[model samples]
Target: MEMTDLRLVVATGALAAVAAAGAVAVWRRRPRPGVPLRAGAVLLAELLLVTAVALVVNRAEGFYPTWAALAQDGTTAHRPPATPGRLDATIRRLAADPDLPIAVPWRPPSLAASPGGGATVAVPAGYLRHPSWRYPAVLVLSSPADGWTDARMLTAARQDAPTAVVVAVRAAPDLDPGVLATGMPLDLQRDLRVTGHRWGLVASDHVRRSARDVAGRDPGRFPAPVIAAGPGPSGLATGLRAVAGQLPAPLAAPAPVLAPSAAAHQVGRHRPPAHGPVSGIGLRHGP
Candidate 1:
């Protein structure tokens, strides 16, 4: 049974009750019970009761939501480390800032059993301060060739689309947009606080060239496609030909999404070529 199941809690409680009844019977059977017999009965009852209480607590509070988490020894389990597992490491840093945005590379497990290209999640600042606040989110689609780092995608979202969460998608040029449109967003919503019903899309010209037909066909998922016209251009062009009518908030009506643009910045020390060049990604739109 899953750890959170109510049935498990009920079953454990019932077993504890049975154990207590058995202990009482053993104690009352003889006016003078031997120390060993009484002790053994009492111990069994205590064990069952303690186990029941633990189950109840675990049910109420998700200490170990899954068995995998409970068994996960925070050691060198030799699992693939989270991509870009370290700091953004910009050249402009004089002092460390604790309030920097959080980024976590996520592989939707549903993709193999469910197909999905890996994506990096960029959580905005103040996400923790307001538990009830849910932010709009966007997916910035670019290939490895574009050199779009997770950090760059996050920066674009913060500066241009300040009101929305952003996910830098590392996807193949030919991969089905359906894989992203249906499953990817759902998986993201399941894990993060962002609204997943619909998402705004940011596509590089290279990616749009190949997947535009498929992506444009699904306005329900990708309501607005903001084109990133190469790295040198300072402005972003809106792709509305495929997206019929004005889209919803974070896309068109409520707050039209500004094309994400970025200023050139320096990286202190990037990963070696063996790990892939850390430089070059996104439309290098001028300040």
Candidate 2:
């Protein structure tokens, strides 16, 4: 088993043992009511406790197995460097496979100073074959709680609009390794997505840089008129990008869809032009 799985197993076993012991102690102390009823109550309580503990541990350790598998593999060591030949070949192979979406790690030289390393890019169909065709790109800012994943973005894009090149960037840097063992609640982590360490400005810059790099590498494959988008906290970043007019040439026009109040507030404050350069049509609700 993987180390994460093993650690989870051990932690679960220990918690179960402790719960069992506690239940037994409670039963012995007050042998009132039916035994089955008492046992059921104990089991329910233990189950809830276990779930709470597991969530805490998962957050603290950054041990989300699903996310770790996808994001970690995109690092420089694992993924081949992006080159025209390699990119074309990979895209061709992926295009042949009906099941695989064209999303992959984007590690252009411009992203060397990025706070969260690199972003994930999802290419549209026929991207490999049409070297002369240029398509609009969208930068997706992700919530720190769930982070960003190519599969998640691709799935969402397929359901909504599958034409543009969608880029999902991580909004937060790595959490402190020492915080993993703390007994803090998961709500704290959620709060940290916004309050503790703000990533709005940095994330916006990352989006700009990503769009520029993609256009620079394959000007004909990915072109101007890039859009900025996100959901929830990430949506806030999108709004910032739109308000600042950070997108490349042929800017997207539609305003990013934010919460009703936030959307109103931003529109009121920024008064973005009716025909602005950032497209924000697909983000009607939270992700």
Candidate 3:
């Protein structure tokens, strides 16, 4: 069974409960060989309890994403990296498969200086449903200490717009805005349908200056960033577009084509990557 499987944790906990009950029953009855029977039951219960706790913690935190990670110091991801040049090919193959979404570990060399190594693109909800559609993209730049989890980003993606793709990354003091403005989209363009050259940005107050620098590096590409303060946002994007805890509204039109303008461009003339991502990472609802 997978180490992070919730079913295994529940089953082990149930067995521990049964063993504990057996120990209690044995003590009350004081049956023949009472000491040994109670001791054996108690020991079994303790072992099972410990096992259950370990499984629960592993599942919750993903300490060891797989058996290989456990053998090592957990540096490896749950999935293996694609072959050097076959990365794009692998992405295309998976893109054809019917999957809800993809959130692979994106650690390209160009943006190595950025905090958190790299950022993961949180694909929009009902992504597979609109196979022909390309999404409006947003880069959510949080401070290094923001603790922006994948689950939280997923929630923000859903809130932002069921159609808008969200990229969550932490901004470091020394991070190069020019590299972020240039490299990340290129890397993502390989796997995602962020068709238009431009992208919207959402930044927390702590990273406001960094966000501005990123936006200024490429005015046509980055545009004005929405400066958000804590849960409440107050910045350039005004009125309905700047809704709190969500991304700006992509369109004022009645129709729901998130990227109507970018529709003309063919996603940098590349096919979309598989929504399921490569073999290593499975789609999870929460972090």
On TM-score, the candidate that comes out on top is 3
Best by lDDT: 3
Compose the digit string of candidate 3's lDDT tens values, residues 1-287: 44554457789999989988887777778345557777887898889989888887665444443344466544533322221122334444555443444454567554565556777666654454444444557777776466566666665555443456667777777776655664455455535544444567877778888788777654555655777755433221221134322322222121211121242343344433444222222222221
Candidate 3 Cα deviation (angstroms), residue 62: 38
lDDT computed for candidate 2: 0.40
lDDT of 3: 0.55
Residue pairs clashing, model 2: 251-277, 252-277, 252-278
TM-score result, candidate 2: 0.32
Q: Write the per-residue lDDT of candidate 2 for residues 1-287, one digit (tens) a residue.
A: 22223345567667777777767766777546687867885986689577657754543343442222335543422221112223455555556564345766655332334465555666655455444322334545444554444665666555443444555656444322111111111112221111111111223333445434333322322223233454334433344334223222221232332221232244333333456422432333222
Evaluated at residue 84, the lDDT of candidate 3 is: 18
TM-scores, one per candidate:
0.45, 0.32, 0.48
Q: By TM-score, highest first, what's the ranking?
A: 3, 1, 2
